[model samples]
Target chain A: MKQLKTRTEQILATMPILAWVAFAAYVIETGAVLYSYTISFVDPEAAKDVYRGLNLYRLSKINFWYYTQAISLIAGLAVSKAVVAWLVIRALTKFRLENPFTMDMVVRLEKISYAAFGTWVLAMVSNGHLAWMMKETGELQGNWISGEFIFIIALVYVMSQIFRRGVEIQTEHELTV
Target chain B: MPITVNLDVMMAKRKMSLSELSEKVDLTLANLSILKTGKAKAIRFSTLEAICRVLECQPGDLLEYDDGNKK
Candidate 1:
């Protein structure tokens, strides 16, 4: 049990780094997509060929509403992911293996859960909008719903509850003797 | 709390210092201080027994029930 706990802690300690890397990748991908759209606007004839071949030419002419929706979706998801990463780093930086049940841990877990839930909501809405846009453009490539986001949100919520219980038990134990 | 710890009174009656009581009871001074200051949520039977034995007193000597509403 001790070995397993240590291993788990080690993994948790590395999670902030992984989350930040993922967030960075998401930002870069969004930037690349936006750049491609910008190129299509600046040089329609040349970029049309590229967009057409890629079957995303329709996206180049997307209206302001759709464009803003897509941008907001990307920005919201990125911000939430970054927030989770930052919270994890701040919360677990001084974690003690001997006494893992703390109010600080509980608060951090709660915040992470809220951020993950927000990300899941944004992902769900964005997937719906994207799917609709694709269908409108006659490029229905199947739904883009991210089950991973929902799963992560649920997992974080459960972890928050677990930490809450841990805090209660720790309090009781402290008062026992 | 309705139940209060009178450990300080007993310690004083026994002419014992906090450190001396802590050594005799095999508990840390901080913990003993918690008991002395009535800040402890609960006390273990073994700890109570050790303290009672070391101080040469009964449990009743170290605990009191305070009814605030009583005249």
Candidate 2:
């Protein structure tokens, strides 16, 4: 039982790192695809003409694409952090709770997580342009429905709850130990 | 639920000081103090066992249930 517990802990500890690696790989692949599209398919002459007519920098065309990509990347990372935090917390809490770690700590942590999640949700929502860009870039290729927005809100909410519960369990363990 | 700890009694019986107990148990004096005071919310079995073994007593000797007033 002790060995099993240690092994499980080792795996859980590595989960966030693993998640980030997978996410990074996906982002790189997507960036490569977009880069190829812009370079190979977009007519440089047409872009230059448009830039000249609008008195914009010729480099601005490529720069805009890069800028938007950076924005999306940063935004995606923020959301992912919140999501991962929520997941890890939830998993750890559930594991400890079922192991009969401590109910008091788990309950208290969950309460805190609820508030944290609410704050995270608001922060994400406030950056509305990020989601809009995802839609503009064909990433969020669906209609801008209320359900979609709610889904984002729900995702953060659920994750926060998980983290809160986990914290409670950890606190309980600390106290007991 | 009210719980009580008897760390001082065990330490006294074992002829061990808090510093010695703290060193033997691989726990900080601060944490040992917390457990001794019954202010800690929980205790790990391993830690309890270590304390008991070092003190030459059972867990029951170190901990007791107090039900006069539940908090």
Per-candidate TM equals 0.77, 0.40
* DockQ of candidate model 1: 0.57
CA lDDT, candidate 2, residue B55: 88
DockQ of 2: 0.46
lDDT tens digits by residue: candidate 1, B1-71: 88899898988898999999888889998888888887788899999999999999999998999889878
Which candidate wins on lDDT? Answer: 1
DockQ in order: 0.57, 0.46
Native contacts present in candidate 1, fraction = 0.50
Highest-TM-score candidate: 1
Query: Model 2 TM-score?
Result: 0.40
lDDT of 2: 0.58
What docking grade does candidate 1 earn?
A: medium
Which stretches of model 2 miss by more than 4 angstroms?
Answer: A1-145, B13-15, B69-71
